[model samples]
Target chain A: MMPTEDIYQPLLNVIEFLGTFAFAISGIRHAAAKRFDWFGGFVCGVAVAIGGGTLRDIMLGVTPFWMTSSIYLICTFMAQMFVIVFARSLKSLDNTWFFFDTLGLALFTVAGLQKTLDCGHAFWVAIIMGTITGSAGGVIRDVLLNNVPVIFQKEIYAMASIIGGLAYWALVELGCDMTISVITAFLLIVAIRILAVKYHISLPVLRGEE
Target chain B: MMPTEDIYQPLLNVIEFLGTFAFAISGIRHAAAKRFDWFGGFVCGVAVAIGGGTLRDIMLGVTPFWMTSSIYLICTFMAQMFVIVFARSLKSLDNTWFFFDTLGLALFTVAGLQKTLDCGHAFWVAIIMGTITGSAGGVIRDVLLNNVPVIFQKEIYAMASIIGGLAYWALVELGCDMTISVITAFLLIVAIRILAVKYHISLPVLRGEE
Candidate 1:
């Protein structure tokens, strides 16, 4: 009999590819604003697309997924193309980028939690990894774009991931089915991100000493 | 019998710790210039100190050094304390930060090369990883501070690391004593960085479309 991961691996790959593409678009758009050349834009896209997962894999003591697969690079290149082709139209739709970014964040969080569990980490560790996987790429992208990370600012980004992670941890702890727990966490992340954006909700601004 | 690594491990640890502290100070200083709060400064400091090594370790398929050791964190914290206490005094020493930063870069490049060799990677990979270890942290720090990375600017920062890495690779290929190889590469990095600054040497900047 095939292992459970093998059974689910194809679906996971699809989700991951979509997430990577979206993250790449977000990064590429940011790079465009800075007038990065084609190579710089491509590099920025790839960095944002894979940065979080690479970080997660490192912490989990595994070879990075991108090193073993060409798909991610191809997807990021495709994302760059998409941005260039639709630059004018995409610029008009302010929420379009936000939608894809949130969807990617939700999908990545669940995938990260699963990978952490597979690596035999504790629930708390899994939650942290989940949040990192969802949010760290954006942090890297924002940094590359030369701005304060939106997550660290008055944005509910990382906090949404954290909540989803907590929900996943609780579901697993309460002996829920694995699929049910994953779906619940994924939905929670998506919903939280949407609501936060729609409501203009944000974390409190951190005050510096005067 | 103890392994050879054990014999030299303490010395490596000391070098790594000093590099970490210096890197943290550089990061904290940048964050302070941006008016970041204490927590933000601390996070940036930690990121700059550990970011390059973490990325190298990930690419090298090893657990991140900071994850396994509390010493890096402790060193970063001490750097933070030093910054807070000497804020007024340090503000006057324009070149002191550059000196420590260059020393840390040289030390980290050699240490990173040694670790990659221990992992049985090829010489070229070790050289690239060494360059990443020496330069990537400052890139991350610059990004976090919302500025163009100094490495990508006209500065010869990464070039200095690349030169050092090439020297290390050549020495190893020539079957030079490992200690001599490390020392020679370290000094080369420091000398190159100093000369670059003194002579205003830099790479040609890439021009984007007008």
Candidate 2:
């Protein structure tokens, strides 16, 4: 599949770096919180940073973005070092987790949606890919940590990504500028996630028993 | 991109059915043991039945096998029903778990290795794919149940698949009959797995601390 045009190349690159770093840090911090060792922490960091995109690339029939560049691996390594260095000071900052996770979710959602469209998938498929891109890494991280996936626990996590993808698709359909559409979608996801958490909102459980 | 020749179609079909059923039952039993609800158990069944092959197909740049056939879904459904019907009698039969898991692992490894070779990948890549196909489903199953993946718990699980794959590759290189190569790989994996468990053999753990 083709990448975005040259005009948006630099913007996309920044998103890639920031999103990957945020995700990597989130996983590393989680590893630290759980008292996993250095190598385990690094593995978690890399998994959170690259898992979603790797799945997306495989589905989209492209080489995974991480495999093509050393930058993402370096970002994860830096995240590992950051966690080790800041362990004492960062002991009680749940907000740090929220911020990085939310930011990564928003940015990755946009990137996945745009990449799917670039690969000529329909809007609905792109939206699904965006949600997967946004949440699958966290699922993997939780799995590795032996926790039931938080997203599957009725949180507004993947839903926020889905909502953002829908808004982006609608804006593009309505002839908005590409940058405007991307910004709006990103902000909307962050706002929705924040509001959902602050207000104790969640999807209702689908009970198996009557 | 392309499937195997029609000459091999029926043989592959039987393997797919048996492998899917065995994996589905293995995961369903795990969920039942964990006291998860029916829906949760069903989810695990489907996840284990299809997850490995889905990943393999995605990596091979093919539409996942389950996407093309309804038979796999039916197999999972039947597995779920089998669990419900035999819940009490099956409660203490760990051998049932070993049988299905080992059989599924062996069958899937061979199927994945053959498919990768058909897709024109090198032998080493095929070996990796075989290991993934054999072990990744169990990883997903354990993850869903919030358990450390059994394969990573120093068990000779994925390694058995890799060894089987190497044997298959060597046999093919030695110009053994195709059926002979396939049967040898599948049986070797099963035998290795059984022997490992019987003798308490395991890979050494890599300790995080000195």
TM-scores for every predicted model: 0.62, 0.60
Q: List candidate 2 segments past 4 Å from native.
A: A1-16, A91-93, A170-180, A206-210, B1-46, B58-139, B148-210
Task: Please write out the lDDT profile of model 1 over residues B136-203, one tens digit for every residue.
Answer: 99888887878778778677888888899899878878999777878888899999999999999888
Cα error, candidate 1, residue A18 (Å): 13
lDDT of each: 0.80, 0.81
Angstrom error of the Cα, residue A18, model 2: value is: 4.0
DockQ by candidate, in order: 0.18, 0.13
Q: Retained native contacts per candidate, as fractions?
A: 0.28, 0.18
lDDT of 2 at A95: 81
* Shift in Å, residue B18, candidate 1: 2.2
10 residues in a row with least lDDT, candidate 1 chain B: B1-10
Q: Write the per-residue lDDT of candidate 2 for residues B92-203, one digit (tens) a residue.
A: 7668667767887888898889889899999999999988887888888887879878888868989999999999989999999888888889889999999999999999
CAPRI-style class, candidate 2? incorrect
